[model samples]
Target chain A: MDDEVIICRCEEVTKGEILKAIEQGAKTITGIKIRTRAGMGLCQGRTCGRLIARLLAERTAQVLEEIPPATVRPPVRATKMENLVTSHGE
Target chain B: MVNKADAVVIGGGVIGNSIAYYLAKYGVDTLLIERKDLAAGTSGACDGFIFLQSKKPGFDLRLALESTRLYENLADELSYDIEYRKCGGMILIETEEQLKAIIELVDGQRKTGLDVKLMRIPQELEPILSGHIIGATHSPLDAQVNPFKVVLGFAQGAKRKGAQILTHMEVQAIRTRTVRGELKVDSVITERGEIKTNTVINAAGVHAPVIAKMVGLDLPIIPRRGQVLVTEPLPDLVTSLLVDAEYITLKLAPDHRGTDGLGLGFTLEQTASGNLLIGSTREFVGYDRRTTYHGIKAITQNVLRIAPALKEVNIIRSFAGLRPYTPDGLPILGKLRGVEGFIVAAGHEGDGIALAPITGKLIAELVVKGKPSISLDEFGLERFK
Candidate 1:
């Protein structure tokens, strides 16, 4: 597998970054987030959610279900400044 | 590029942005730096709760009161709409134990001159609230704001006042020097370059302790992870910031575990766009900011305890933030000994949005004028040592 393969496009996180995070004791998806910031982007982790999880699972020799997904936050999609600034604008 | 500033504030969340805004407003050459965009971390992840009712009755509540006062006209003053709302709050009492705690909580707040009512909440306030709740404590003073806008507004306002906000400029290290038998922060080394500043304010949120480490002062601030789920924008289900008594107790008391074994507390809020923002947990999982299946499941089931109609609601997103947890549950403010020109303004775990305004004003006052408008004696770093 190419280490350069992009995992989290929102943050430009790559498989190399994910692998490095895993090597640094990132046993969980949340752990990976803290280390590489893979899921802390615009889409919040929806796009790269499974790719990072599967990579973590493969490395740890654990089932995919064992590795949890990263936390998804508000404005699940790209939001305009107006929607974010004003209450009723959304 | 090399830049010199009178004060350099690290972190781009509400706290740092507020400090930058205040410092710039005070005519100080300030530089606000962030590793990510504004409100990208906990400020963006958590709900926009400018809550005062849940504050601990003494200095904490006083701080909330003062901050709320600052927020009253923040949108007008900033010339940017932050979506500030005093939509009120209702803390649900489920168990008899919760009832007693809330009674004491409200009594303490009332003694502090906060207008709060302890009774069966009228159906007009929140008809969707579960009938199973024994009672609720309602406070009109409770308010909220768009955390993102608050950060953005402060950033733009601060920029307009000539504060340089450098996003993606990560602080690599803290450069310090000894002059006249005193250790002082000489300059802040960042990924971009060096920022020579006499004063450095650590408003770095959950990453605060890591910043404190550079100065050799061990702050006992730990990052406590909290998760929240966002439901599709629905009709006005609840008008108030609805939370549980267990949530309040767990947040106020660190030693106490969940009233229920699941360790999940319900916080339901209806955003201006009509989305049901439900949250959260106080898991001590270090700096891992990911949403877990168990965490989401717990929040969903618990919120259902308050509003059964939510069982069918589709969750659009799930996210988490790392709360800057201190041992005593109080935020660390003011300067530390041995590190002159290094001020500590972080450790606001869950109440960062609520306390940002006051923190900014007090810290800025302490920096520029050498005396804060309010006494910060109790919140100083000496108590932690």
Candidate 2:
């Protein structure tokens, strides 16, 4: 069902590539993480960003706080290259 | 996969590497593609604030005071280390109707000469702001930099003055012809092929109306978005560049609300590594770069209503960017009247990174001087007809 569901657990990104990045227009969720890199791995989308914002508010009928949640950046966990060579006083 | 150029440009952010660094420093033959990479959009989700104390006095505060005097000599003319900071901004005035609409916007940016003032903010200036402010303005020519080192210092000064960036690619159309009856624009079909180039500069930010509808032109340029956050590296707490003087009348309409509807407030800055760059929220919400939970809870409940000691900082990250907007917040910039060799630099919604180097030296003096050292008929595109 929907290619074994799995919508982006650290970029496994499914639900059939978020319905093929919503048939190629995406409409948001940072346009399906720039079209399917899906919340960009390494827990960046914090576990599939509210399940791809509830599958883009149930495929656009719009609901869940009006679908909006992609655009999370930072070492939200995972950086240590000695914090990128000491950005300053660790 | 044929190529050729006299200009192609498209978009690589920081206004397509400052119009491919002044169209290869006037030698032309530039290229510059990029579908991603190079501040992958909205110049890597902004907040550098080269702010001119919130423009809007006329010709958008005289083209933001000539792009704040070209970022005070753009890091020694692009030797590149865009940490460019002059540190002096403030704004605040948290209501008495935002101190009477920020004293008529610091008296229309001090009659457009700008040295703002209005003072009385000091609690050691930023001992974590929020003394429940009643006033504040202090311009000192507002500044800050590092929009990914100003798009890698204008794509390394347009590839050491030869130009031709081409990352990831993907343009796809804008071929045009007509010849005797008029029309122009010769090539640029990209997904990685045809180049040709008669001169095509869209600077596709917020996908400039899908690259001006591949040359037929119907540009209102939408996608407004915004949203931002980042903290973790404290210690300085937030020195200069504050902003929230009702975000210049919520950037003069794009439905950027806040008559208590969470006015897309604040535009804070502070980086140079000390983090704290919270920001923005000017929805229209088309190219949704997300981060909404009411735009990051109205930017941390409006940055803890002016830093309630930043409720123990540590936001770390959040973003969203897209701001091509243009419903008269200015920025259309020349061309599109009968098309001819296409131009239009792109709508500068939130002032495209403080007007990317005077819109790449006025689109490289309108492609090596066809008239444009200033006088873009109020940035036409037939003022959106």
Candidate 3:
């Protein structure tokens, strides 16, 4: 992949940026995610998590399976504040 | 990995990393062991407010004041851009009862020579705030920084100064030896290997008790859950870190019963990236860090009551963090009485980010000089007894 190629479309992180993060001692997917904000967008790494793991493995020469997936927090999908609450216009 | 170090600091959040940075800078052979990556715990999942006004007057407030002063030049000193913003802070008051409570709190803080005042919400912030918000307390000293960057900066600085930072390495056991009929820390045992050391510092945030329990000590630290909401990047909707007066009530009084078994506090602040980060609900769910519908709903309802215009803003994400709550609000710092060569620097709870620098400096001072400039007597583990 070219350095300019975008890996995380959600955050617009490119291959070069991720490689820089790896060089900065980010060995895992979560490490790269935090350093480059690759998987921190609205999608919350759903889209770019595997891509980031592969990139990290390639750069660090680690097995792809060994790299853990980035942490997933809930609402699994984005929900509106109004929808979450029950009482309306209090 | 080396078999020996002058000091071993456990955990790699902002607290541990900051301790490592200071210890390494002071010319100690420091080794930091983190179970996960840096800022992966409470430090990563929370807001970045260096809010001095919210602190209880006297010990806690004085410590925050000193820490805020250190943060002024921290970025330059660490050679890292932490996205520091000294935008000040406010505590919004909705009711006359809240106003009365805030006045008393502000008066206590003022007596300590802190530059805080109770006043109407400034005109610039007036339009965004709901009309129900009657008043606010403002302090120029309150500030914020990128929490992740701060952790990374400290870790990097520590590494530059020859500290060995081993991430993903969990300390399974703390090995100790009784020399001349006195027990002393001997080494830290990990799954991979044991690193021999005479000094061990626990800065593990909420998980400090787990490490303490390994050494036959019981730390009275429990995890209090807080859930926060984040908005999509937008124009500067809020400048300063804003919290409801009720948040202080929930924080200061542990037994203060809140609505629906959850302590909901309105904390709204716009990040440097332009996203308005709002939060939060303090609940005692016993280390269950999941954001529930009940929590999300409570927080949303509470926040909207203070800033109704934020209704249109899209919430990008919501997350939860476990604050290390001690019996007292203050952290358990300094060495334990029976534990030789062991020091504790955890249990800062929500104030960890604000007090990181001072905690680090004080802990390092205790390790190196056997005395911190600021006495840790009040903050020691003995206080709980």
Model 3's TM-score against the true structure: 0.96
* TM-score, B chain alone, candidates in order: 0.97, 0.35, 0.98
Which has the higher DockQ value, candidate number 1 or candidate number 3?
3
lDDT of 2 by residue, B108-138 (tens): 7788788878877555677788788766788
Clash counts for the predictions, in order: 3, 2, 0
Candidate 1: segments with Cα more than 4 A from true spot: A1-90, B259-262
Instruction: Give the alpha carbon lDDT tens digit for every residue of B1-385 in model 3.
Output: 8889999999999999999999999999999999988888899889988999878889888998999999999999999999899998998887898888789999999997789877785545556878767788888888989888999999999999999999878999998899899889999999889999999999999999999887888899889888998877787767778998778887788666486777787788888878777888777889887787677777888777777776766677788999998877789999987779999999988889999999999999999999999988889888778
Which has the greatest TM-score? 3
The A-chain TM-scores of all the candidates are 0.80, 0.36, 0.89
TM-score of chain B of 1: 0.97
Compared with the true structure, model 1 gives a TM-score of 0.82
TM-score of candidate 2 against the unseen true structure: 0.39
Clashing residue pairs, backbone N/CA/C < 3 A, model 3: none
What is candidate 1's lDDT per residue for B224-293, written digit by digit as tens?
Answer: 8888877666777787898887788777887565754435767878877576778888888878887775
Q: Per-residue lDDT for A1-90 in model 2, tens only? A: 567778777547778878776654355676576546576444667778887787777776678787667644544564322232224321
Worst-scoring 10-residue span by lDDT in model 1 chain B: B255-264
Worst 10 residues of 3 chain B by lDDT: B118-127
